[model samples]
Target: MSTYKAPLADIRFALFDVLQAETLFSRLGRSEATRDVIDAVLEEGARFNETVLAPLNRIGDEIGCSYDKATGAVTTPPGFREAYAQYVEGGWAGLTAPERFGGQGLPHALGTALKEMIDAANLAWGNFPLLSHGATEALLQHGEPWQQEVFLKPLVDGRWTGTMCLTEPHCGTDLGLLRTRAAPAEDGSYAVSGTKIFITAGEHDLTDNIVHLVLARLPDAPTGSRGISMFIVPKLRVDRDGNVGGANGVRCGAIEHKMGIHGSSTCVLNLDDAQGWLIGQPHKGLAAMFTMMNTARLAVGLQGLGLSDRAYQNALRYARERLQMRSLSGPKFPDRPADPIIVHPDVRRMLLTCKALIEGGRLLGYHASSLLDVIEHGGDDDERAQADALLGFLTPIVKACLTEWGVECTYHALQCFGGHGYIAEHGMEQLARDARITTLYEGTTGIQALDLVGRKIMQLQGAGLKAFLELIEGFCSEHEGNPDLAEFVAPLRDKAGEWQRMTQEIGGRAMADPEEIGAASVDYLFYSGYVALAYWWARSVAAAQTSSQPDAFKDAKLQTARFYYARILPRTLAHKAAIDSGAAPLMALQADRFDA
Candidate 1:
């Protein structure tokens, strides 16, 4: 196995060349985040992850985390705690946080890039900060001023970690089914009682205290999701003076036994009369939790992105070095006994697939982050509102598409290793295992698909869809006659038009039968994702065509763009066909008929 190295060149190309992030940063009034500062951050982040975290990837997976039922304490694999301390001391947790809250207050666009690097280096270890970032988002958005003063700073500074406790034993996707309860207490606190299962980093030795953002029903709250309220329940109590008190009523009943990401402790949290406080208005906890969830969904997508990148790097290295048989064309390595696997066309297919997905997905993910920067720092309210709408539209696609593609890309990477990939010592299987969960958690692909089709498109009346289509059209129109980009520009415009038409068609059919939405949703989501990636790939080719970079780098970008257009973009056809098929074939079979 090879050590993970951050693809700094491609990252820079995506940020500067494809997305023009520095220009956007300046326009957004983020003067502190100069290109030089951002570059330095990436360099240092790469160094930290490559050295400190990369080496621990295998150990984290092999040894995993150990949990103690007696004390409700979870111990991370070796070096996990010390590594987290180093992360905190380096001020990484505060990178994108507000300066007043002890963060560097950098644009989340840049922070998201740094996050991708960290996740790619060590995903299991990355969960600690990932959850913390989500928790920070919720508090920053909806927490009371005092709550921000106390909880936000600690989490930002990494003195403590956080977890979003939403899923209960009975309810995973349906928040309305949650059985957790929160009752009013005399001291102005609420008595929280609930069991939140599948809580990542819920109980860990990485921090002294764990901040849990739990969703529970209040006494006077309505039924279902509407009745739920968001609560701030700390594992260790804290006073008004920012002092740590004794342990709260929260305990880890058990930890889950999982296939991958074993290093990150996934705990079953028991909140027995736990002292807690509300973050947002009552009966609106679902909305408040979404503040964290939106950020988390994207973060989970990055997990998939990171693992795919890591797997590709390792598999590509192995392919180049591993001697197999003679190439189909000729003997490329005449001096050696046999040619490397890279000489094989089939192997190249796998390598190119991984490369194209990562590079294109990088552009898609980074562009979404830039939109986030616009939301936080845009010049005017209108621009911010537009940015918000665009971000909301892209979130589900970014979360679902990148993750699903991550699984596909990783599978290709592993196949490049052939039989050796299956063995544990090679570390390829672990990537596949870690990737399986990304689509399931943070809202499953099905749920994200539903959100994209039903909520974002239909409910919002295609506000986000229109924004995205306008972006694609603008780009296509800008590059209308350029011979260099003509190949990409034309197809992209056609796809954009088709996407809009498909959206309208689905909306029309859904009006007659609501089941049409669910039936077409997953395919529509995939269709949207493919089209979105095609736009990014075309943008990359356009950037490469006009760049002053070396021929090798520019050629690689153009070639990969071509590969995406030719091989990957066509996958959208199947998705479109599935969407056009509508709800009949799927709904024709009753629930009981599925098993039979």
Candidate 2:
């Protein structure tokens, strides 16, 4: 497999060329994310992931995490503790954290790219800290003022890590049905008691302290999701003097033996009167938890982005190096027994699809990250609202679309390896198993689709969603004259418009037939994901042409942009057609449709 190169040219194309990300940085007065700064961060992130993190992946899966039932502590695969110690000592833990809490307060753009590098290098190890970053972000936003001073600094510094304890074994999708409980204590805190399953990073030796954000119902709390509240339950309680104290009440029952991500522990946590403090308003816990959950959903999507990129790199490498059947035209490697696999049309097609999806996803992911940066750092409230509202609608898209395609891209890339892909050492099989959870975890594709069609798109009568569609249309209008891009651009725009019309029709019909949303939700989600990618390709071509830098490298970017549009961008049409019809085809099956 090809070792990661950071894909700097492509990342530069997305930011400086297509999105003019540095311009936004300058305009927003974020002196830190300048072009030089971004380039440096990307370089360092790539090296850290490649050197410190990647080597542990195969070994991690081999040894996996272990639970000591007697002490109820989870131990990660060997070398993880030391790796995490170095990672924290480097001050990388708070790259995106707010400065007030000792964070670097950087924008999401750098974070997004950095995450891709780490995930692609070693997803199993990467998942552990990713959860902490997200959980800390939520606490910083909603935790009490004193709580920030007490907790945020250590978390931001990576001395302490965090986790979200929301999922119960029986209540995976429905937070409203969670049975965890919280009661008042004499010490002005709450005593939390709950059992949470499938908790990633729930128990680990990577940090001195593990802060768990749990969802529990109070004595007088409201019923359902409305009655739930969010609490901060520490594994090892902290004293007022910043001293690490005794175990509170939380313990690991057993770690799950899953098909993938074995390096990271997924625990079933049993909280026996754990010392806890409420993070937000009573019965408003679900809302606050979603803040972290949604953030996680996006992180999960980026996880997929990284997987697809690495998978493509691996497959593309194998295709060229390994000799295969002779080409139709002629044996390109005339002296060899056969020809390079790249000479085959089907091989090229698969390669092209993987590239299109990964690159397209990279574009979309970065754009979303930039929007978040603008929302947080920009001076103008209107600009911030525009950025925030737009990202709010796209988060589900970013999370759902990229992860689903991540799985698809990995499957195709693995197939290119033929029988070799399925083996343990080849590492392709790990990508497949690891990428699968992204869909089911961090909200399933079904839930994300429902969030898109039912909540995000329809909310405010489609104002935020319409704004995004309009943005894509505006780009087409501006770039209509570029002939090289026009061939790919025009058809994509038409298809997008077709999908938009179908969605409008279905959305309007949804008022009378609520089930319509559920029936076509996945199709609609995929349809939007399809056009969103087209928009990325179009922007890429425009930006690559307008690149400020010089010759050889920029030309390569323009070529890759063309490759994406010409060879890979057509998949959107299939999704559009699926969205435009056949809800009945899906519904046509009898009541025993699921009977196996």
Candidate 3:
């Protein structure tokens, strides 16, 4: 199997050259996040992920997580605990967390680069700490002072891990249908009773405690979503002084048997009146949970990007070495028995497809992460609000597009290896399997589509779309006169205009029939994603041209940008056609008559 290597060069280019994250940090008053510091963090992160986590990926897959039914304990694959200990010792758990809570106080954008490397090296292991970010966000935003005081530090210091327990047996997307119950205790805490399914890292021996942010309905609370309340239910109870004690009512009923990410424990968590504390306002759990969900969604997008890059790297390497039939043009390597498959046009198409999507998707995901810095530290209220708006709008797009593309890119990567790719030894199929979960979890592509069209576009008046379009216009206007950028600028500008018009049209149609939102949502999201990448690809080429980098790097950027525009961006045309078709054909098929 090909070894995992962190693409530090591309990561640097995306963060510094294209995004100008240093300037962003300076403007946002993140004085400690200097260029030198960021570089050091990235370098160390690369080393840790490549050396520590990457080696365990296949082992994690092969051994998986072992469950002890008697004790309700889940043991992670070998080397996982030691690697996690090293990760904690390196102070990576709280890299982007607030310093006041025992964190490094760095920018989220920098943390995103580190996360991509971690996911690429070992996606299953990365799942262990994934929800801790979201849980930290929830606590930071809504936890009471004492709760934060008690929980935040431990989570930041990596002494304990966290989980978001929102899904149940009956409901996955619709939280209103949940049946969890939370009853008040005399000591001012609550008793949370619920069975949360698909809980990642719910019960693990890696940490002394497992912090669960659970959704349960309280007594006298209203029915449906409004009745739901969030609670901090830990596997081991903790005192106000932050002392870990005996077990709470939380237990791992069973660990799921899955298709991929076998190393990551997906648990059926049974909280039988678990000792808990309420977070935020009464019956306002879902609103507070969004804090964690949004964070997780963005992280999930990074998971997709990481897997795509890993798959692409291996595919590219294989294509250059794997000798096959002679090139149709002629034998490029006549001295050898057969020319390398890289000489073939179709193979190049698949490889280029992965390249264009992975690179462009990198900029897209990183840019979204930078918005968090703005939201957290922008100089003015209006600036922060605008950043928040834009972040909200782009979240679903980033989550859905990157993950769906991950599946596509991995497929193309495996296809490049021919029959050998399908075998487990090559590890290509594992990536293919792993990539599938990113789209399905953290709100499926269809769910993200509905969120994009129904809520962000229609209900919120497309504030995020408007912010993104302004960015496109500003870039196009700034580069319109640059002859070097003329090819990309014109097309990007046109797409920006079409994006705005498309939003307006969807909004208008949704006003007449709500089903139009559902029908156009998935297609509209893909359309929006393609246009977003178009803007980023153009920016990448512009950055590469102006940088002090070598000619080869700049040339590759330009070539990839050209390929994206010529081949990948045209996908928006089909999506636009689907959107223009409206909801008539979809609803025309009756429920019972569908089988006919």
Candidate 4:
């Protein structure tokens, strides 16, 4: 597999230039959190991911993880524990965590950027702590004071790890059918009894304890998601003094052997009368759990960003190095036995394809993070509400499209490597394999699609969509005539037009036929992806123009923006057409039709 390097330059550029993320934090009144501080901290995180955690990415993939049934212990692939130590020791463990709990209290934008770095270096390994970060977020928002004091401190300090336990052997996407039960004790605690399957980082030896945020129905509560209550069930209970207590009721029945992310330790967790405590109010667990799920969904989108970067880097390096037939016009490298593969237009197209997604997607990913920072830290109530609404609307888009496109980015980037890409040692295959989970977990693309089409669009009687279009329209009007970015600006306006039409069509069709919306959902997702990326590209183009830099940076910026508009953005057409195609063809045949 190809060795990984942290893209420190591009990351810094995204922060300081395109998103002006540091400036956003500054405008929010956190003046102490300057660009210089953010840059230095991000640089350190890069090295940790590059030199510390990245090596184990392939190591774990090759050796895989181990589960010792006799001792009921799990071991990560070699070097993982040590790398985790370095990551925590570097003080990156608490980037976005609350300062009272020992975190640096950095903005969520920085946390999102840190996420991108780690995922690119080592996706499987990156997942371990990222999951913990999301768990901490959920607890901070919903957990009671005692629960926070008991668990959040250790988690923020990286003294322990965390996991989200929602899916079970019998149910996943539909939580209405979950069988787990949470019964309260007179002593003010609860007992959780049920089986949770496909739990990532569920049980591991890297930490003294694993704090699980689980969803289970209360005995006398209402049915479906409404009946569920969130709980804090650790692998091994911790005493009042924070010492490790006896084993909790939760135990790992077995770790799943999966296609990719073999080292992640997906588990089937059996909670047999497990001692637990409710994090939120009775029958309000789904609302609380969404705190973590939404955060994870956005992080999953960045995973796609990381995976795309990995694939692009490998394929770009190979294109420049690998030699083949001479140029059509003339040999670029006359002395060489064969021309470098980059000379091929189709190869250029593939390289450009990955670049378009990664670079543009990075802007949207980081922009959303900054919006989150504004939501948390901005001084004005109006600004915070605006940030909250905008972030909510885009989160699913960031989650669904970036991940879906990210996999395609890897697939195409890997394809450019030809036969060499298929080999394990080349690293192209690993990039593809590792990115596969970004779409499946947190919520599937289908679920996210339903969310965007069903929930986000209709929010506040189209207030969310109106607010978003206003922002995009404002940008297009201001930058329309600029010679430097006219090419990039025009397509963005065009895409906004496309989105308006698609939204109306989906809305009209779903009103007449409900299932029509479900069938067209994924396409709606891609259409939104196209529009989001277009907005970011316009912003990025503006960034490139405002910078008084050498033409190399300027040229590359405009070229990438053009590529995104001209090539990648056009896919929305096919997606829209497919959405308009409706569910008729897809659901036409019953199961018995195949048998016949």
Candidate 5:
């Protein structure tokens, strides 16, 4: 069986040392997010997850969620409901929500650490509360005051969970093709009818009521996506006075037998004339639903990060204890019958790759969360705008790259165990299976790639990219004279320059041929992600050197950063080459000629 202990030290280092989140929170007037408070939260969060949720991970995976066909209800694995109850009782569900909504009113950046712990501890269990954060965002931004009082408060305080009912039987990514209909009622409510598939946490026993943020179309609306509207449809009807009643035409038709995260119910939700209330204006649902989708995209990225960390921890432990062949050069432990597999160069390479990606990726994800704080609370409008732009640029990259890397890291970790990793008992295969879903859900990597190149980069004129480039340039300029950092700073500066040039080249080509965007998107995203991590790794090395940590810790950071630069950073070159190849090769293959 696998064990999980939250990586609190690395999390704190990324939050305070590398990102200086405490200073940023103070500057943003978030007085409640003091270091002591944040530290205590992290401690309690670690304790709860490690003690409560971690023990249930294997059982959840083994037993999974059971669905009652007659009742259309889901019974989660034995310990899942209890764990969620404890999570709510501990006030963790509202850790970063508004104080007025019975929340603790903490910073989103601080919550990122706790979220990571929960996911790492039990990702299946984590899925239940995950969509609630997204629902809270959608409601706070678009829900009416009465709706907020009825729906958003419970979502925040963890009395009820939330679901984003977006995908339908026929439509996964194409919202314009959806057939869900919302008919207006005389009593100011709407009757929603649709069958939504792959709805996570749609019907769970963890909460009494499930608030579903559903997308549908009104009768007189325009065609396609512009005709869409969002509605709040609860499993059980709730009046404006906040009283819960009987079932409101919402029921679970079926549950998908998935490849991973089985304890988290992936439901087929059938809303048959369910009583619903409009959220935001009609015919503009996609925009409003994006509020929830964007939040889920980032949270999904954390899912990848958490899984990667857990996989790495177990792989490292296995490598240190499992006896294998002696070192290639000579045996360091002559007394032992065989040296540990950690003595092998190839094993070390795998471990180093995991370390580099997990640590650097932590900074990547945390920095994006800090940007949310600035956008919400920053005093200066210009600063807030910059943070928002930077966040927009980083979101797709963070979501796509971290998830793709998660798949890679899990593969490496499983490989470290040799034959044992393939079995069910060792639990490496479970982590690998769970990690697979992150890249596909919220948005596929391909969708994220297109979003980055087409929407964020070309349409927004790469405002986020420009902001990020400035940070790299400024960091390089500040550290150019420091001999200790010259090795990292020089290459980082070079990659930043290359990143800007590549973006311009892609932009120029996209103007002549629009298909170029689709062709260059995935490769361009990978290229940009590598360069971005290069910048963070350099900063991490510098922070480690100057911090009050032990010499061994500093040396480990230095060595790992070197390994990343030498072995991993060169991956950007391949992506750049693919981006430079243009769209010709891909387009040359005629669709009908493939089978010939």
Candidate 6:
């Protein structure tokens, strides 16, 4: 594995130059998040990951986590707990959490950048804090006053860990089919009885307690999803004074044996009449859980971004160093026996693909986080509402596309290694293995696609898409006459128009037959994602053209923008075709006749 280094330069460029997050932060009243502070945090975070976490990436994969069945406890791979302690002591767990709850209250955009570094350094170790951050978001949004006071502080303080227990052995995607039940007790608490499988960071020895945000059904609740309710179920119950008490009725039945992220414990949590309290209103669990899920989905997208960048970095280094064959034209290194593989166009193609995706995807991820800052702290309600809508639409796209690209980029990175990539010792194989799960968890790519095409576009009448399209159209119009950017501006305008038309067509078809939504969903998602990245790429090109930065930096941005449009953006054509195919081909075959 190549030594992981935080891409602070790109992160800074995205924040200060491309996204202008500093301006957004200032406008949002995040006064403490000055450039100095953000930079310092990023630099320190870089050091932490480089010196501490990066070394553990391979170790985590090799040792994995050990589960003690007798005690129902999970011991993370060696050095995992110590690294976490350093992480907590560094005040990283609450980097963007609420100030009232002991967090530094920095902008989430900064946190998102830091998170990418940590994830790239050690993805499995990153999960522990990742879950806790998601849990904190849920509680901050929906927890009761006392619940926040009792649980939120510990979580924010990094004294306690957290987990989201949603999937069960029987029900994975369909929460309506969940069998968990929560019965109210005389003391206003509830007994949560269910078995939640595939719970990340569910059982770990890193923290004093694990606060599980559980989803279950209450008595007299409606059937299916409407019946579900959210609960605060802790592994070790805390008293009113915020002191850890004896074990609640929660235990780890077993940890899963997984292909990747071996350091992060995926547990089978048995909540046998566990004492719990409702976080949000009764029977509105899905809505409350979404508070956390949305946060998680975006973070998961960054996981994809992180892994892809890491793979690219290592592969690029290897390609430039590994001597393979003479260039078709001539040997770039006349003194050497053979030129480095980087001299090959195919290798350049793979490297450029990774670079384009990571840089462009970084913009998308940071832009989403910037919108989050607007939603949380922008003064104008209308702007906040618009930002909220756009963020919702981008969330699924960012999650699904980035993750899918993670898989693709890793494959390219591994291929660059030749047969050496297949060997375990090279670390490319681990990157490939770990990238597989990003698309699977935090809702699968298919689920995110359905949500995008079905809920965001159809049910919401494309409010999110409309807001985003308007921005794209406005940008294209602003730069339409500029000769230098006319190439990008013209194509972006056409695609934005096409995207709007496609959405309207899909909406009309779905109105006639709801199945049309499902049929066109995945393709619609990819189309939207590609177009979204195109807009960001255009913005990047504009930024590069006008900037005072070194020509090297500006040239890289312009070249990548060209590559994205020339090579990657055309992917929208195939997706649009697939979307136009409609439900006929998809639903033609019967369930039992799939084999035919």
lDDT of 3 by residue, 115-169 (tens): 9999999999999999999999999999999999999998999999999999999
Which 10 consecutive positions of candidate 5 have the poorest summed lDDT?
A: 545-554
Clash totals for all candidate models:
0, 1, 0, 1, 0, 0
Q: Which digits, one per residue and each the tens of the lDDT, describe model 1 over residues 1-596?
A: 54699999999989988888889988878889898999999999999999999999899999998988789989999999899888988889899999999999998878888889888888899988888988998898898898999999999999998999999998899998999999998877899998999999999888889999999988888887889899999999876556788999999999899989999889999999998989889998877789899999989888888988999999999999999999988999999999999999999999999999898888888888888888888889999999899989999998998899889987998898889889887889998888888888889999999999999999999999999999999999999989989889999999999999999999999999999999999999988888998899888888887776789999998898889899989999999998898899888988998899
Candidate 3 regions exceeding 4 Å error are: none
The C-alpha lDDT values of all candidates are 0.90, 0.82, 0.94, 0.84, 0.93, 0.91
Better model by lDDT: candidate 2 vs candidate 4: 4
Model 5: CA > 4 A from native: none
Measured on C-alpha atoms, candidate 4 has an lDDT of 0.84
Question: For residues 1-596, what per-residue lDDT tens digits would candidate 2 score against the true structure?
Answer: 33555677777777777778878888888887777878888788878888888788787888999888898878889988888887887778888888888888878888888888888888888877887877786777787877778888888998888888889989988889999999998877899998999998988888868889999999998778889998988888865445668998999999999989899899999999998988878788877788888788888899999989888988999999889889999889999999989899898878888887887799888888888788777798988888887888788899999999899999998988999999876889988898898888879999999988888767656666777878978888877887867865787678767866887887877787677778778878887787788787777666766676677756655666667666655666676576657467677778876794
**Lowest lDDT 10-mer window, candidate 3?**
235-244
What TM-score does prediction 1 earn?
0.99
Candidate ranking (lDDT, best to worst): 3, 5, 6, 1, 4, 2
Model 2 pairs whose backbones collide: 222-227
Q: How large an RMSD does model 5 have?
A: 0.7
Q: Top lDDT: which candidate number?
A: 3
How large is the C-alpha RMSD of every model relative to the true structure?
1.0, 2.0, 0.8, 1.6, 0.7, 1.1
Off by more than 4 A, model 4: 239-243, 587-596
**TM-score of every prediction relative to native:** 0.99, 0.95, 0.99, 0.97, 0.99, 0.98
Give model 3's TM-score versus the native structure: 0.99
* Stretches of model 6 off by over 4 angstroms after superposition: none
